[model samples]
Structure formats: C-alpha cells, structure tokens
Target: MVSPMLSMNQATIKHADLRQTLDTLTQTGYHSVGLWREPVEAIGVPEAVRMVSDSGLCVSSMCRGGFFTMPEGPERRAAIDDNRRLIEETSAFGCTVLVLVVGGLPQGSKDLAEARSRVAEALAELEADALAAGVTLAIEPLHPMYCTDRACVSTLDEALDIAAPFNPKAVGVVVDTFHVFWDPNVLRSIARAGREGRIAAYQVCDYRTPLEADPLLSRHYPGEGVIDFKALTQAVAATGWHGDIECEIFNRAVWDTPFDEVSRHVADAFDKYVAPYWPAE
Candidate 1:
C-alpha cells in the first residue's frame, strides 16, 4: 500500500525554532509542516514565509484563526479582524487551509446553543474575506470536554452544519482523531464530510486513556494509546481525502523530546499504524 503524504504539525515540537524544525522535517522526509500562528507571528510573517519557502516544504495548514464566541463588542470585533489577518498570513505561507477553533461559551454564559450560534454568525462574517484570500476556513471541532472553554463546536456533524451555508471552497471541516475518535457518530460524520466536499484537513493524534489533569496535553503519538489508528485512518481514506495527514501531538513528554527524535518516532508511528491503510499505488 502507498503511504499517505505525512506532515508534522509545529505543536508536536513547539519548542523548536522554525529553522531547526524545518531542517529536522526535511531530514526526516516529511512532505509538509503545519505552521502555527504564534510562532509564525513571533518570527514576523515575511521571515516565516522565506524560511518555509527556502526549506522546500509544503505547508499542510495553519493553526489557527477562530475564537468568535465572545459577545458582540470589542472582543468579538477584534477576533474577526484577527481572523482576516490570519487569512492573509495563511496565504503568505502558501498554505491553502486555515484551521479554526471557534470559541466556546462567552464569559459568564452557560448557553451552548447561543455560543454555537455566535460561531455560525462569525463564520458568515468571515466567509467573504476567506474567499478573497483564497484560503479555506477549516473549522476544527474540539473534543466535547473543551466545549465550555475552547470550542463549542465539538463534533464533525456540527462543523459540517456550520459550513453548509457557505461555499465549500471558502469553508470546510477539520477531522482530528484525538478530538473526534470518541464520538459514536464519527464514521458517519466523516463520510458526510467527504460526500459534501468539506474535508479540508485530517490531523492524527492518539488519545491516552486516564485523562490528564489538563486534558489539553493528553494527545499521544499514533501507536502509544487506545485509539485504533488503522480503523480511523481507513475511514478517513474512504472519503478519498487527498490532503496531507498531519501528526499533531500535544503531550508534555513529546514537547520535551528532541525534535529529531520526535520526528523519527512520528515517522515510525505513522508507518506502523497508518501507512498500511493507504491506497496501493
């Protein structure tokens, strides 16, 4: 079987400098790298562009540009403006998709329905700009656990619903195993996303059992946890997804490991757990 093209999300080596990260990715044979906004902004957009361009690596996607659940006021306005800028940045990086973690409930509010409504509204506001920038806004549904604070859109079905009214070229959904694996409807939702032509990105990471104190950092490398990568990968492949499959881990241990070591481990994990399911050449 042919292996899917592999990309490493920057969060997997959050501590590594851009040059070092790109060097390791190229040396390790990664086809692409997922750039994060924080690090890109830190180095300045022009420098970041030149570094990635010089590395001769494709950008899988940019992380991220959403947080629109705030009530209408300065905060919400600022988020919209920031997202417009992110769209520009994503274009500058030569990346086609911009991942969006639509914000959770607004401060002091418990209404999930209302919070989600705000996300849809915000997407509508940003759709024109995204289209103009030629960047697809890929809404990433975080795990339900983060619905209260990180992202209210916690399921692929929900993300699709939000993207339905917009042009698929301008908006779509992100399929991340760590967040959606636990959902019973994930397979169907993935298929729906594929049928609708809204599968913008597929991010791979394992879910470690026995939740950590801060569940945000609980993601593990593909084969180290309870997730059935083979099954999940096959499901995603069934959608005929042709984009990069990014390995995005958030474990503290992984963060502490050397970038080269992490790169080797990730490549091994992808081969062992995911590559076999890819379509045969």
Candidate 2:
C-alpha cells in the first residue's frame, strides 16, 4: 500500500497532462497530488478540479506562481497580475498554499541584493491578495546554482527573512530537501521555521553529483543520492506539522520513463527513504 502521508507532485512526470498525472498517481495508490499550472491551465481549472475530484486525491499547492524580481516596470506589474490569477486558480483547487519561486537577477544586472529586494517588494504587493484569497504564498528557495537565473532565494533562512514581514498565513516558505540538504544551518533553519509556524510545504527529492548539463534536472529519487531524508523528515515532524509529504522529482531520466513506471519508482523510493521517517499517526 502507498503511504497515506505521500503525495506525488505532478512535476515528476513533466510530460504528462492533467489527466495522465492524476491517473499515474492513483494507479500507484498515492493519496494526493501536487499540481503544476501549465497542465492545470491546459485542461482549464473547472475540468482539472473535476478530474482531481474524480481521482479522489487530495490536491497540494500549485507548482509555482512567483517571478517578480524585476525592478518596478511593466514586466513586474505583469508578473504580479499573473500571480494574482494563479492565486485564484489555487483557491479554485481548494488548496491553502500557492508556491512562489522568487525570481533571480534580471539580465544585465550585477547587483543580486537589489534583485532580492524586488522579491520582497513583490511579496508586499501580493500579500493582501493572497490573504483575501485564503491562500498562502509558499516561497521556494532553489539551490545557489540557480540564484542567477531561476531563484534568488537559495536558502530557507533567506526565504524566511523575506517572508518575515508578511503575515505567516499569507506568506510562507517551502523546505525542499534537494535545495536545502547542502546547507550547514539547515537543521537550525527547519527548527526556526517550525517555531515561526512558517513551513508552507515539505518536499522530498535526492541530489547527486555530476549534475545534468541543465542542473535543474539533477534531482533524483529519494535514497538514490546522498541526502539524509531521515534527519530532515524527523526535524519537520518535530514541529507537529503533519501534512502530506510531496515527492517532487525533476530528473530527465525519471521524466523520460513511462508514467506508470515512474509512479511506481516514486512510491518505492518514498516508502523506503521518507515514509519510515514520517511521524506515525
């Protein structure tokens, strides 16, 4: 049986559409699913919701909805507006969390600090909208390698600092293992996030050496790499935060495989490396 605490994120099967993603999860006995906007939008929200409901799977947050690192301009305004629409879509799914990927420095910009300030500014602009929609913006800190082009916030501590000024319910952080496993202060940061009640989501994925040419595709199944899942999951559980544990893989090999095989692999890996560490009911 699939662990009741497990939810397979849609991004693991990047090639699958809404229906295929849901089917793969259910076929493998997963109890929930994490969504991605592109696939969800491709099928339209109403139909996507209907299909998710039909699958009888608990839905997690949208994969992402933040990239407002640009200095104030038409582009920044447009990003905020698009995120507002994403918030509405998240609410439609009845999920309380909407993940944010605070964008990196704009082209021709050498000042990383200024770019991060823009992330803070963008959060301020959207905090009220997120609150009004009853959705929490979960800020995801990608690995430092991605700081220049994907996400500027590369540590949980930094993500939390950026979120500190905003209401915790309206803005929060994602403790994704792949990005944070390398942080020496990660344990301290996890404890702090729990104390602050700011862990919007907990995601599990392993990282290995010889990263792909596109490093973003370097994610591996739990235990397939060197991360200490037991340590992190135990720390997250220590907070009395019992939410679905999402397996969100981004490896090209995993995606290139058939969805059914990928789902089974995720289930096996999650059960072996993650579920055992999760707190028991």
Worst 10 residues of 1 by lDDT: 1-10
For candidate 2, write residues 43-115 as lDDT tens digits: 8999999999889998877878988888788998899999999999999888988999888889899788998
Measured with C-alpha atoms, the lDDT of residue 33 in candidate 2 is: 91
lDDT (Cα, tens digit) per residue for candidate 1, span 14-35: 9987888899998887779999
Taking all chains together, the TM-score of candidate 1 against the true structure is 0.97
TM-score to native of every candidate shown: 0.97, 0.98
- Give all candidate RMSDs, comma-separated: 1.5, 0.9
lDDT agreement of model 1 with the native: 0.90
Strongest candidate by TM-score: 2
Task: Flag regions of model 1 displaced more than 4 Å.
Answer: 1-4
Question: Model 1 shows how many backbone clashes?
Answer: 0
